[model samples]
Target: MKYNKTYIFGITLVATLGGLLFGYDTAVISGAEKSIEAYLIRPLGLNSLIHGATVSSALIGCVAGGMLSGLFSNRFGRKKTLLISAILFFLSALGSGFPETLFFTKGEPSIGLLLAFNLYRIIGGVGVGLASAVSPMYISEISPAGIRGRLVSFNQFAIIFGMLVVYFVNWSIAYGQTIEWINDIGWRYMFASEAIPAALFGILLFMVPETPRYLVLSNRDEKARTVLTRINADRLRAESILFEIKQSIGRVTERSSIYSYGKVVIFIGILLSVFQQFVGINVALYYAPRIFESMGAAKDASMLQTIIMGFVNVIFTVVAILTVDKWGRKPLLITGSIGMAIGMFAISWLAYNEIIGISTLVFIIIYTASFMMSWGPICWVLISEIFPNKIRGQAVAIAVTAQWAANYLISSTYPAMMEYSGALTYGFYGLMALLSALFVWKMVPETKGKSLEEIERLWKK
Candidate 1:
């Protein structure tokens, strides 16, 4: 099939805005964590438990959003579901930024206030979950089979780009602020920064066409044909795509059951999602500032380093986009898992031996780089490709929801773990990385050049 570079790029960019919001919403909290805890939790006399809840409230929304994506995307179409997600992101940003005004009393922090703030965060979290599940699915469905791996990877690139932008924004805002200033006012601005990108996402989302698969499912044959023609620029190829979509939708409608595949595929999908989070990628992305602080760095220095990590994440994700199709998904996952394991082990050793210096930071950069080039993007690619078309949306939703839950678990527990075990916590992450390598080797099938139909057949075999 001939590809229309302009159409592909345009649609990919719009769909990838979902990734941008995903990154912005998830990582923005890192910048605000210290400040929020200091000003709101400490001054309000909240305990650590409530503090943790405040931090993880968005994650709860993520799981809910992920689970709902299947239903919404299946029912309302991918484009509309994404529109709803954008709305949620906008509201969450506004609500989270001014929770005191929205739901809390002035100059007071209580469980009630914290709950309200978390509720807002959860709304955004739901957006993240929906975006995470739907963005790549949208990209995968629209992308040409030959270039699908690379195009789908653009979603990850956007995510890292979003993370990088937020880190810079956070650093710039907090650059010269004293702890008092940051604790009092800086965090509010940090969260409010998301409103800019969220608005951009909403506007851009309206510009993209609905997925052809969605169009065909709704019996909008002429619209589907038009979209396919624009994407492939060939009448024959466009009709072929429409035919495939029809077959897939027919199978799904005929089954009329979400659990048509029984247990094994669901288990694999859920495990893939769970492992992606269990490896603690977000612990690094979400808490890099705090981790650096624990290594004896100042707040400003930590924020700067976090920005650097975000930069590295973006660069490596781009590299993954360039190389995923050529290198194949399994190889990248294997290499990433091994590299992460080694990096994590090295960081653990450095911290455990009281080597609180540049070496520890260097190891972290290596870890983040390895992950970005491998599991960070590759996992999403695999998830979008591995499931059959008939059940892909539902299966991917389950996996993504599991991922957010795992992410919440890691992020919520890290503070306590650091307080207790410090380096040992990293050692545990290292071990999980190693196990991830084993899992990839044993279970993950390479789907580099195959079409989605071909991959589904291979998996069924």
Candidate 2:
């Protein structure tokens, strides 16, 4: 059977725009967070908690969006749910940039305007939540069995690429600018830059066909057969594949719930999502510049360091894509977790000693790269593959919602944690990383080189 490589790649690329926007909206605030604190929080008589809340406000919407994903994706299909996410992304970007245009004067800080700004950021968060769950699921459903891990990993690549792009964008916006200007206007431009790609994602999404698995679920067998033919480029192979999918669906009765799939599978999925966030990955991302600044680097230099970290992230995510299917999931995850534990433990030592210099940077790079290569991408891949098809949408929604909720807890508490003891904070993450290695070893089943339906059968066993 000949493969339609270009056509499949094009469709995968389009679906990954959801991932690109996910990374963009989430990390854009990293560069602008301090400026936001200066302009909005301090002037309005707020404290660190409110500043943290405002910075992480999008996570609240993420929880809502993730919780709603099953209903939305199941009812509307993956492509349309992504379209809705893109619309939300577009609106959030513009609204966050000019939050005061409708209700308040420019440059005048008010509680009302502050509320409006958070509202917009949260809208963007909702978009992130939707994309985080649906994008990989969409990719997995369309991908061939042989290279599904590599292909779905492209979404992670897009995610890291998006983060790297925004890091550069944010740095460019702040470069050669005075602090006052960055506070008053530069941050707004940083927020607004996301609008361009958000619009692009929304546009291209219409060009891609719905996943064949989705078509099968909708009982459109002929349409499913057509899409599968194009993707597989073999009518006979497509029909066989379609039959297998139908067989899987037949096993699912209308009364099936998430538990019907298997308790262990759902537990593993939820735990995977939780451990991914609890290891403090997002804290590193959302507060990248601040972490660097705490190491005695100047503001601009800190942003520069953030860009460097973003670059490392992209490079290592590519490594993950190249090696995931080849090396298998367990080796990469366990290896990466060990690396993270080492880097974080070293950072904790340095922080306690008040030694902030080359060593700190090197350790931070190591930690970020380790995550990019392992848990960062592999976790998503497993989540997309592990659940039974009958319960995938709902199971993924529950796991992702837990993920965002954990993200909010870790990220929102980071400031206070840092203030109290940077040593303890980093040391704690290091411990989680070590524990994560053990958890993966004990609980996670490797899904490499398996069809989605085949992998689903593991839980039933």
Candidate 3:
């Protein structure tokens, strides 16, 4: 059947905006973290633990958001849940930028003010959690099997693009500013910048239809058929596809049994989410500037290096988007795992030898690029595809919540871990990379070119 390419991509673009905001809110901290450390923690004589917690406070919200996503997406439908997330993003950006609105004076460094800032960030994290889980699910549901991998992969592309944009935005805000000015005001602007995209995402979300699979779940068959017809561009094909979805979904209330597909699918989904974070990708993302600065680059140069890394990420992620359907998921994931291992192990050796130079930078790019090509996007794809319709919502929430919790543990502990030993820290991630390769090779089933119903049957088998 001929799919409506224009209609498919048009709504896909809207769905991906959720992904863009997820990246924007998550990475915006990269630029503002040091200033947060300087302004919020230092004056209070807080240690690195507090500093790390303050920086990673959003992950706490992410866990909550992830935990809640299944319920919200199930109840509200994917499009409306994303709309909710966009609203949260907007409020978080403004509040995080001017947390004093919560009634604490700026520069006071009171515990209350710190709490307020983290609160706003957590609110945003919830948005990221919802978007992260629902965006890919939405894309996967609406996409045709032939192009689903590529379309769902675009969510990852949007995410990386958003991070890159924020990295550039942050850099622009601080390019000519003095340290005092940056610490005092530049960080606020960096955070406030997110509101623009957040607003855009919220506004555009209204233009897209809810996923047909979701409409089926809601018992809105006519609406589902209408959406499917537009997306498939073949009335008969759409009807057939709709029937297949109903057969797979089989009474939405009855399908929600989390273990209805058996324990293996859930376990694999959880493993994918956990391994993604354990490889220390978030460390590179959240602390790029600090890592570069520690390697002796000036502040501006560190930010510039981050932009370069972001560029590489964009390029490699595009490679993944183009090849995910062609190369297949397992090949890409296993290959990426090996590449990431090599990158991290090399960085570990460099740190062990106290070697700080261009090599360290090269390896960091290699590590992030390897991730961008593989686990970064593939993990989300698998989670969105692996479960049966009977259990997708709760299962995705469980997987994603586990993911954010793992992210919190890894990211929040990095500072103390660094203090103990940077070499060991990186070496540990390298070990995870190797293990991830083994896991994918041994367990993960490839879903390339398979319809969501076909995947549900595969899991049932």
List per-prediction Cα lDDT, in the order shown. Answer: 0.86, 0.92, 0.93
TM-score each candidate. Answer: 0.97, 0.99, 0.99
Q: Write the per-residue lDDT of candidate 1 for residues 200-313, one digit (tens) a residue.
A: 888988788998877877789999999999899898988887887787667657775656655666777787787788778998988888889989998778888888888889
lDDT of 2 by residue, 240-318 (tens): 8899888887798674687987688989989999999989999999999999998999998999999889899999999
Clashing pairs in 3: 255-390
lDDT of 3 by residue, 154-235 (tens): 9999999999999999999999889989999999999999999999999999899999988998889999999999999999
Flag regions of model 3 displaced more than 4 Å: 104-107, 251-255
Output the worst ten-in-a-row residue range by lDDT, candidate 3. Answer: 250-259
For model 1, name the residue pairs that clash. Answer: none
lDDT of 2: 0.92
Sorted on lDDT, highest at the top, how do the candidates line up?
3, 2, 1
Candidate 1 local lDDT, residue 60? 95
Please state the error at residue 242 of candidate 1 in Å. Answer: 1.7
